[model samples]
Target chain A: MSRLAIHGRDLLLDRSARGPSWLVPSLEVSRGERIALCGPSGSGKSTLLSAFAGRLAARRGSLQVEGCELVGASEAVRRAHRLATMGQALQDAEMISYLSTVDNVLLPLRLAGRPVGAAQRARAHDLLARLGLSDRQHSRPSQLSHGERARVAIARALIAAPPLLLIDEPTASLDPASREAALDLLFSAEGTVVFATHDPGLIARVDRAFDASIWREP
Target chain B: MIVWHAAALACKGLAATPIRAVVVVFGLALAMGLPGMTVRTASHIEAVMVERAVRTPVLIAPRGSPFEVTLASLYFRGEAEPRVPFFVAAQAVTRGYGSAVPVLVGYRASGHPLVGTSADYFEARGLRPVQGRLPAVLGEVVVGAGLAAQAGIAVGDRLRSDRVRPYDLGTSQPVELRVVGVLGWSASPDDEVVHADLLTLRAIEGILHAHEPAGSEAAPGLGASVFLPVDLSPETLDRVHAHGALEELPVTAVLVFPPDDRRRDQALGDWADHPELQAVQPERVVSVLVELLVRVRDLLLAWSMIVSGCTLALIALVLALWRRLRERELALLRTLGASRSWIALLVAIEAGLLLGVALSLAAGFAWVAPVLLLGALG
Candidate 1:
């Protein structure tokens, strides 16, 4: 049996009819594969990524992630599975503004009620350093530049080394150098990657691409 | 381990908003501090009042409020009541029950009560001079330990009584008396008194006069002067006597000590029917006052508790608003796999840290307020 990270059959992308419908309803994501959901703005690329992360429930059809069926699972079970296996960076690069860069990276473990021992702290520091934020570890989100904040958010998502990573437009607002650096970090990350973006150049770097524009009514 | 991490995070979060945290902590401190200090001061006052009353067995005063008379005589609280004859002390002593010490509280020197009593007053109150000697002459006075230290007046220092109306021309002149001794601390109002003899008080009241020869013209009414010069010559002593028999002089109250329970009952029974006098057990009077104080303390405690509850509610409200404002942050935490319980625990820890700091500050304020207040008053 092939090990699949995401398996969907006739999965309705939106729970309400007010949103756009899916053009290609069947999809499969194999382990260690880099899949990009590409489309124009409002074409539902972020929505598909959110669905894969289990943030929104499918209106109908079968959906499974890492061999676990999520279509009818309880919210708690889905959340638990997401926390244990999935690392996600949303569009806003939502960082806890009051926390320092290192503390923000360690937030997932803290939220999981896991003991943040010296090893965990060192891991967080290493992640920040790898993201070119070693000197900015003690700085608050407000003190960091926009690119720096995006890097902090990415570092936070990957701190736990989840088996599956979900990133939403990770390099949309970054400059060319920062974008290349961010792409380098994302592709180098060890896991199954499903990211949402409209940048065709970024789409060419992934193993496979799913066009969300095909689902648009026009 | 999880709790500790959450607490550390909570502290960091609070440190991020230093001004808001300080405001919340200080609001809680005032909520707790004012009542804490009030209760402490009331407890101290009650203890001192009860101890003084227990040591003093009974009070004999002309018919009036027993509470007022007991306070005035035992605690030197100036209360105006009809004066009883000085012979009452001699009468009570002759009864062979126990000693009767006269207390005349009217004048004040340096804002401290000037108490005129016999030498037995010190013996009855178990007071001993820690410096110099007790007043042995009419022109001498003994200062309380606190009064001596506060006024910086030691043995041989001269103190003048404050006239009732300093600006009034017809009022008696202020009397100057020598401080012959300083009594030890008694932890009661007695430690704030200026102790003198009845003759000294009478002289200050201008009721004692010196006889002058018909040919002598020192001054017309000057012989009735209330001021006592530093030097008391033999002639001054001979002239300054009660205008009439000493027995006819008035006293404020007489502190009576019964030798035994039987004598106490006997004396109480003897004065039970007296139309113009009353013998009261001072402890009973003090207990009533203490009960009132206890009620007041309970009321204050209740108000403080209500204020504390309001403060807690306000904190919860603020936290709720804060939680709402941090929706994205919390949603991010949820996305990161934080359990709802963990979020709740983090909030609780934050509140606990804030309350702990506030209570510590309240305890400090409670400890310091009474000392500062009493010192300022003194």
Candidate 2:
């Protein structure tokens, strides 16, 4: 039921100090699938993820997630859909720092005003356990190793059962074995995943790949 | 469980910025504590004044200002005794009115002023002496609790009048007044006064009389001693005591214990007719002080409410901005399916928790401030 569909779109992201219209976009995504958005180092891989999460404006064309129109939605509704229906794992290390792993997993539920009961804890714990972090449930991201913290971030993004789990360069800091383990966990995720990474080995495992440079606007 | 999560979030956030938390708590305590202590002390004074008013049921003084007469006669708060027509007391009692006792309140024992009245002063208003017997003669004294403790005075100790004033400038009194009694605890205003009989008050007249200019003596009119008695009855007191004569000026004010309110009013009406006399109820004067105290408390309450509101507003504003800066945390919460309202609630809960701690600290400081003020005064 996670139809994380995207339609014709354009996006402008300042890739260099070069100019404001550095990267523009036209793109699409659908549910129960994994799309690896890839390009050379300066390509708009992360920008497409931001646009998919509705955190970035396309400047043209329509976009949607969990069957709801995302672009041009009210600021509140866009933020709501982004936090609630979409599971977003930032590739950047400067993610939410003050909260513990368990609290971080429950962030969307907290925003949704749902009771964070034993059931939610169990689900979050199982997700962390799958990421081989059963014992690190209460640790802060700062305390975890890069690989371990990336896995925890991925688990946190997926804990809410959102229609789309968006991950950005999750394997950038992972070692070979941990990177393969992270790929296995993502390839097996229940909902659709739209992730961007420079890793070619990681891409061969995904259901599909889109060269983000081809999707960019002129 | 939601509360637990909210508390966990607040603790994490506040723990990250301990300096901000400490400053907020410090500001709240200072804002709330100082004014509470000052207002509380003023309230205590008002309480004491109100208690004094009710406890002294009647007052007698020479007819001038009613409030001044009441204050001077009962509270030692103002000037000396006035010229009372001694014979008028006889008329008051004969007309089925109450018994009247005169109080001469301006003498001092060991530099602390004494209140002089009859044994009826203690009986009509039940005050017990803590030690030693009642004053048996002119030189005998009965000291109050405060007067005794403050001056280090005790029974049988002899004291001289330490008073040296321009009006009463003379050699210190040559009399040896014996402290025959010490009063028990009476936390009322009377605890601060030394008690003596009317004869002791008239004792001043004797010392001043002999010190008079040699040629200024008038008929040597029955030395001041002739006005005092060891065993005085109304009959013998009038017959032998010169000041109790038709001619001598009367004692300060007469406290009449009228048989009933009707007799009191009748006595009051009778006194009202005379140009030089008046009757007053301590109850009415006390009610006025009570009214004043209530007004003061209400005024303080309004100001305190304003301070409290400001403290809450500062707390709320700080928390709101802090939450805004912590949007990453809000995003994390939201990504976990937390609603906007839930995130706001966590922030609110954090504010309430900090407020609770701040209020407790301020209350503790407020309670301690009074003790510190009283200690400093002591």
Candidate 3:
């Protein structure tokens, strides 16, 4: 495994036509470490996370995930690397409305071209059980509560046992108890987690915290 | 694996919204099937009509609309006005033209037209009994297969002829004729008519009557109405006689069967100059009718094809809207590592499945529609 899960130097994130760009002077995250991107709203925390997920091309900077350059990589290369190594749970859980809870949790494996054998299924069931969603496995996304859908999304992200996890506002819709449980599940998994959030508790608990608000250009 | 996943996703999405799927399926089926059905039905009707018309080479009737004369004589469907004398056809036969079977079809029995003619009518038409002998006497009737089935009449059953003028005391009363035979299935209008001796139909028209008994006499001062016996036996048939000369008796038309085409042409030409009679080749009249039907069928086919095209466009629009509704979900899948090709595969599979089912149903409907139409026509 690469020691540096994510390495970057002077990265410029998302330069839109009408919006100001945000800059990261330097950043480094190690394998098995949990880092928090802390900032106010519109401070480019989410934009920086999108850059880390290889979804957005940085305007100017050197950025690499697990020793593979992503700053100027082709789309197919970035997508393949992301599918092989990274798991993402964006805001709102983003569950497919037509799929049931269990199927939604199994989507990552299906997309990765991985055969979802009994072992993978058992792991998915275990993750959902831990997240208090075993009873709702067969229920469609529309039938589940917002928090339950969030838990299903978390289960989906962890199903492939990806080496890097990128999450945005994972505990926003959860109550205190469910928040702690979700955090525990995420930290206990074997991977480096880089999450963007405004939660002080989450920032304090991470191995390192980077404030993105200062990088937001006026 | 990717293809399987895409297909499964598509099936699940269609099953999730069953109403839309069903609506699109049956709508497409109707749009595709209707044109084929209409074309087949029209063609079948034309073939049957043309075949029946070809069998009867010449028709001699009173001077009138040739089409009307042809239909009334061959199909017993319309009224041929100003009936001609039976002798007009018989005189042509006497001139070595061909045999003429007089058709007097102005009476009904059990809601079916009673076509009165000589025994030669059966020989001319190549009709045979499926159950018993053909009508050999005046009061005996031969029912067609279709009429027998519809009216529930069989050989040896008695059928009552409807009165021509029930309110007029001078008109003939209802008479009972014995069903001597049921004709075989001919797939023609003959299958729905009741064939009897011409004298029987003439009796029903009040042009002929039978006396009550040998000793019965009418009062000289008062003219009494003569009512024919309801049941005509050998005794009643002996007393039955025509009011006019036999040669002057009225016949609706005459179906002439010539030995060859030359004889048929000669017969038609011979009657061409007659003052009160007209000769028509049935095939020519029916061909014109068939051609008109073909035009109508082509128009309907074009219209239905347009409708099918519109239905296909509507279906495409519905699918586009469905994709729009699921746009966010697709983005979510992409974010979760599904490639663009996989999503394209899913949409293609869904559309292909719907088209396949619709086409299969359309084919099935096309195959069965003509039979149902022919049955309805009968």
Candidate 4:
């Protein structure tokens, strides 16, 4: 599996100009580790994940993802980089309410302007099969169970086979069995995965744990 | 393949969000209907104007707007009385410009119009009374089909004319006139008026003379009276003497027919330049009305364009933000190795397709609208 390196130095985030919390004071994660971000509530742990995903701007930091330094990169360049190498499974799932499960899975192919031939469809089917969710190929996200939803989300995230995958508390809605199943699926799959959560069960299963309270609120 | 995929995706997504589709459809329908109603109202006014244009060819009136003269003579919807000597009408007929007809109408019956014109009006349009006789005596009258429907008047029915004082704004006569004829249904413009002889109109004013103050050492006759339907050569018509007072005996207009071909063109061409007569093409007037209608429709089209632009912009903004909100979905798409331009293009094409559907529906509405209006008016 190819690795995704995340290196940020002295990142400051603010929702406003004058007074702002330091979302990530400093953080570094080299490639090839299943890292868990752990902290009490409101400690900028999620902001670190968001910064890695480029959903927000960090005031002061050098961010390098897979050796592409994005400290002063253009929005277009960042978008291309994200589209090519980053995979994010959101906390809220963000499933398109109208589209079916299979269409949703193939949307990345449609978005990338790649021909979705028989091979891509079969590959998607195989990925869905890994989560024991082959039957939900036509089911909407709403109709799926919590465990099934988590698996669908995982399949959607891993669909494009990105080098770095970012998942935010995938186990929040899942039972213990489902959480373990989701964790097993997330860690065993290829790539450098950075998942943030305080769940002890999930933390014990990771290769590294980062205590995230060291970042200061500006 | 790309367009088809976008269309399918748009339809599916819109189908999934049924409430949004319903809201948009209702909004568009309301936007189209309000302007359509305004256009239909204006068409009814133009229709009434078109009917009046067929009867009279030239109007001899005081220098005023042609619209006023046409309205006064044709539709009788406005002030139709034009102050010009009655001899002007007679001159046209006598000179072989066209046959002359005298029209005097400024009264209503139960909100329906009552016009006093000569039998020459019927001769001009080839209308023969299908019932009873034309207005012969002072109290005799003829009713039209629409007026009959509106007033419940029939042949032999004695309809009372509301009387006015001298110089009063009320109708001319107080006498109850008997309807001796009901005109046949012509399905044209003449189906809404009640016609009488020009003499009858003059006779009513003759009553006005009796109401005038009779002073000592004064002549006992009304000044310069009568709206006459005259016939003579232009040379003879020009020779006739006019009363010193120009306001009295004003003919609303004259419908003339020249006796010779060369004289007719000369007369028509001459009349177009004449100070007394306003020779207007009825078709041109109607064409102007049609042009006005086209302008109104063009204005409606412009407004529709504005609304469409606003709707498209709003939809684009909403869909763009919606895409943002659906980060997981896009992320899944991106993870599939999709290009950014491709995703944006799919969205753009989807919007274009929806606009196409709306335009087709608007066109269908525009086509169906006129026929429905005609049916309702008829």
Best by DockQ: 1
Which structure among the candidates has the greatest lDDT?
A: 3
- Residue B176 in candidate 3, Cα distance off native in Å: 7.0
Q: What is candidate 1's lDDT per residue for B115-164, written digit by digit as tens? A: 89999999998899999999887778999988888878899888887775
TM-scores (chain A) of the candidates: 0.92, 0.86, 0.96, 0.87
Q: What is the interface RMSD of candidate 4, in Å?
A: 4.1
Q: What is the lDDT of candidate 3?
A: 0.83
Writing each residue's lDDT as its tens digit, candidate 2 over B1-378 gives 566666767788888778988888777766666467657766665666667665554555556667777777766777655677655556666777777767766666667777777787777667788899777656567887776786788887876544434264343343346788988866555667777776655554442223222333532544432222122222333332322343254666777878777877787677776776667777787677668867887787678778767876886687678767888766655444455666677878767766777778878877776545543442
Model 4 per-residue lDDT tens digits across residues B117-206? 777777776666778977765557788876676567889787655443446543344445668898887655467777777655554543
> For model 4, how does the per-residue alpha-carbon lDDT over A87-145 read when each residue is reduced to its tens digit?
77766666666677777766655554457788888877887776667788888878877
| Model 4, residue B139: C-alpha shift (Å) | 33
- Candidate 2 lDDT, tens digit per residue, A1-218? 43446554554454344533434445556667888988887567887777667676555456666766766776567777776668877875444587778877676565555688899989988888877778888888788887787887787677777778888998998887777777787778787888898789878878789877764445
RMSD in order of candidates: 4.6, 9.0, 4.8, 12.1
What TM-score does chain B alone reach in each candidate, compared with the true chain B?
Answer: 0.78, 0.63, 0.80, 0.56
Could you tally the backbone clashes for each prediction? 0, 21, 0, 16
B86: Cα error in model 3, Å: 5.1
Interface RMSD of each: 1.6, 3.9, 1.2, 4.1
| lDDT score at residue A209, model 1, on the 0-100 scale | 92
TM-score for each predicted model, relative to the true structure:
0.82, 0.62, 0.80, 0.53
Displacement of the residue B281 alpha carbon in candidate 3, Å: 2.2
DockQ-based ranking: 1, 3, 2, 4
- lDDT by residue for model 3 (A163-211), tens: 9999888888899988998999999989899889999889888999888
